[model samples]
Target: MTSKFDHTVYTLRRARLASQLGAQGVAIIPTAPEQQRNRDSNFLYRHDSYFYYLTGFTEPNATLIIFADGRTVLFCQPKDVEREIWDGYRLGPESAVQVLGVTNAYSNVLIDTEMPKFLENIPTLWYPFSIHKGLSVQIDNWLTVVQSKVRSGVSAPHRLNDVCSLIDEMRLIKDSHEIELMRTAGRISANAHIRAMQFCSTNIRNKNQIFEYHLDAELLYEFRRCGSEFPAYSSIVASGSNACVLHYRADKASINDGELVLIDAGCEYSSYAGDITRTFPANGRFSRAQRALYDVVLESQYAAVSSTRSGALFTDPHNAALRVLCKGLLDLGILKADKCGSVDDVIANKDYFPFYMHRTSHWLGMDVHDCGAYSEPNSLAQNSAPSPRVLRTGMVLTIEPGLYIRPSADVPVEYHNMGIRIEDDALVGDSACELLTRDVPVDPIEIENLMN
Candidate 1:
């Protein structure tokens, strides 16, 4: 049942990166180190997204060294029979070259000895500073060693640059293989959201008179059943007024009658993330106030998702969704025209911060909030705003719009303590973007029917 890993894809990725770094340069990217969770137990190992992107090697204590002359050397842990009995398998050096599709592989013991020779006379050295403190010290030590050999005519690198920015740009655009993995991830995450809804609706909502952690358990069960490696982020299962607080993770509140539950959770499949959010009635049906608020948020989400195409500015989705949210709040009497002025005035002054605060979209891929620069580096005057980066084909992002109405003196009683958010994974295309997480129902009626 086991198939060989696609070694060709990783080799090609190195070739692309190598071309960017010329023959006179060298680049070193290392994977994440293991961290201890308790006294003796280590946290679950997950490879760095950037390291996994280039080498596709998941093992910790590994470093990838690539030269512009089409040479790649992977330094990793050597095989040990005694260690293997306690831990798992390791490809080692010899087997790593054959299976991992590297030009050469070596044990970690040789890194300090061999890396100095690789750095000699290389004009430009690329390293991600401010990232790994230990690696930074090691790189400085290597430069010092080469500098000490100046009497023997050995020259060290005079220029040190960051390779992380370039890799961040590269990861912004997902390839065909990455897109497929994310598509599978989105499907799995969507089904988990659906399962949470059904789990909340048992026994006419009597069996679901439980804590928010119970709902989180349902989500976890479905994610595992559908082959997801882990949740991309901590599951946010907020109920009633707790939903008004963003990034609420303490899932300990009780689900009361007429209150809605907001679950913002995602899963990682094949190392890519699938982000999704859904708000539904704790019971099978929505209350009048909940239904009205949900409709507005859903409409705003559609506006945002529609703006996710290529050639669109990165802020286009947020601007589009904000327009809809402003009008929705106005229509609901949450923001009176006389008190908050016209929609144009509210937008000009950013008067919607109280109700709809966060941005509408963000880049999505291996990490939940993936890498990439959001704006063009200030081509404007010092006091002016910079223009947003334009969206491109093959880029994946999230389109999320929400409205959170907490109790206030100005807020109407019916709209108080109600929070709603709708989110989906989007793949930018030639014209419009494709929805990857469309398996779950966004409509309240559709959710209620499925739960029933």
Candidate 2:
């Protein structure tokens, strides 16, 4: 099968990776292994992000080897007509060379026999040991074969390194292609939210009778219609008190007419993810207390997004949003002034955590919470790694601020069992951040109007 990718680009990536590895370094990466979903049934195959980053190959059971001399070698399954009739066509080695622009290709059956030769003479080996299970034993056995040959004057690689460290830096900053795919994903997700709102808005179905799965079904339908690989995460269709559960998956509850429904969901497009959360009234109009609480969460989200621009520290947005939420909770009397102290003291003591529990943002990309270290490199001499700082252009993240008010004595009765969260995906740019999910309406009135 031919790839849609510009094979030259992947070749260039391999070249860059090889140059970074130096002349004696060799790296081996593998696509994700196929997993059984049930008896005699397999889950959909997805290429490993790190492997696909280099090769763009989707077929399972493939391994990539990059040598320090800028050589990219692939070992993959060969074409089998019988297997293709059931599982799908395999990108045989010959086509991989032509389609993926690799230096060489061989059948996966030859890996055990041929990889020992490729491992010969290399000093540093780069592979993610913790990521792929059973990979360590495979490497150990392969090295044992190489170790036996030391008398022949060929030494196996002696040093080990995590490939993620090298690839994480590259993936942290979104390239033009990645950003475009994310943008498309955001569009599809935004529309799904709108469709959910419309489904709830239609008076033909009473809000009290609408099940959480009804809205979730709408999202699933929209996601597939728009060509998503899958949902970035399990869709959270939490209704009323269920909204306070955070990662709620049970979608059996009926949406009450006066209660708020929180839907936190996103779709993965082209292996990239778009995450968004929208909280709206089940009946399409917020009551007085709900309106006040929703505004506070929305304001906190805005504060967080404001700090998401380029050059801001990675922690800046979280801090900025926390301040807004703490103040909001204090003013609303959800947190007592005497007990919680001043807003500064409240933050210092983490008094705000009870109401607003989670951090405001996380890096978003190929994975929902994408790879990339939060901390910058530590100085070898001082050896202290400080908090992560500096958001550069091309970094994408989510700004989500939420307030969950479960029933409590101090919590106001009007707000009991209310949970509100607003989130959006933002891309750091030269001057500001672009709101990828901007198409989704956040204003209470707008949501009400759309629902009406």
Candidate 3:
């Protein structure tokens, strides 16, 4: 219901994409194919992010075609009374022209017949490459048809370009509508995290055993209760030693009374994603050692957040977080000075890899790990990594700096098997960044108070 973005927004996006093509160019994009989950049922359908961006159409078996002259055509499912009785309603091709602002509309069954006609005599063709299955073969068949018309003076396209590359540039920057949906999603996800925390503490207080799945259920209830469509990804509800595993899924593992529970979860509201991670004690009180390491990770997140403003390089926040994490590790004796030397030496040698394996942040949008090139285009130099992309306003990214201390003889016993991560969604601004997922508290004291 919140997807009330004006239809003109999609029209403008299509026109902008069309202008990137030459006058005779044709672009085709399809929604995600529905998959059969079992013998009788199908997986929950979700439209393709790229297709939804340009068309705002959610139905399956749909394709959108745009020409260089700003004309748009859509192919969709045809009306069927019998099928409609079983499945839900569909906006068939008849009403698509008026409803979707397309220049023409046709049933998907006409694709093979009509596509080749449009392909004839085109100088360039554009479609998503390496993403859609069987699309390349379909294009080849269409080209074969066009080639057969050579004697009739019809020519096939000479140049083929990946349409996704062109659209990626447009999607990298969020429009006003996308920002609003993301803000709402962030709020919903933050509330979900708070609910999970409260549920964990309540269960412990009631002298009941809390399984990881129990907390996961609480997160899902809050997400849907607050109007989120679904979880952005599989919820990571790791407790105790399970927290040391970065991508662990919520399972039946019982959460012990004094163990720290790390929940990395978020919700998707209107196709946009919110990603937040928080770690707190199951008993609603942080142990002295837990608080120490938690403070270090929180400080690193603060450093990363401070470096997320516009005009900063994409890697600046990562670098800032890395510096703080390395210093914290050194001060905490996680990286021994005898073997790892100073913080700079530890960083230069990547001595912290065992504890912090993943990057500090990633672009967040429609997909949890959204689409965007991290490096500046054509900025690669000899014997060096590509230059990082410059941060810009309207760009959304996650600031998640974490420390995972797996049990080891080299580490202090009290700090063993402790994993702490404090994450929030950050929106880049002119002078600074706005933290979107802070509706939930990150401070240890505040977390304990909320749990109590």
**True-structure RMSD, every candidate:** 1.9, 1.6, 1.6
Q: Which pairs clash in the backbone of model 3?
A: none
Model 3 lDDT vs. the true structure? Answer: 0.91
lDDT of 3 by residue, 1-452 (tens): 12343567788899999999986999999989998999989988889999999988888999999999999999999988888899878789997787778899999999999999988889999999998899999999999999999999998999999998889878888889899999999999999999999999998999998799999999999999988878999999999989998899999999989999999999999889999999999999999999999999989999999999999999999999999999989898888899999888988999999999999889999999998889876665345778889999989999999999988889888899998988999999999999989999998889999999
TM-score between model 2 and native: 0.97
Clashes of 2: 0
Count of residue pairs whose backbone atoms collide, per candidate? 0, 0, 0
**TM-scores of all predicted structures:** 0.97, 0.97, 0.97
Q: Which portions of model 3 miss their true places by more than 4 Å?
A: 1-5, 380-385
Q: How accurate locally, in lDDT, is each candidate? A: 0.87, 0.87, 0.91
- Tens digits of per-residue lDDT for model 1, 1-452: 02367677788888888788865888999888898999999999998888889878888899998887878999999999988888888778888887878899999989898889989989888877677759988998888888989899988988888888678878888999899999999999999999888887773366535788888998899989988989999999998999999989737888776788899999999899999999999887998888988998999888888887899998998999999999888888999899888888889888788998899888999999998888754534356677788899999989999999989999899989888999999999988999999899898889899888
> What TM-score quantifies how close candidate 3 is to the native fold?
0.97
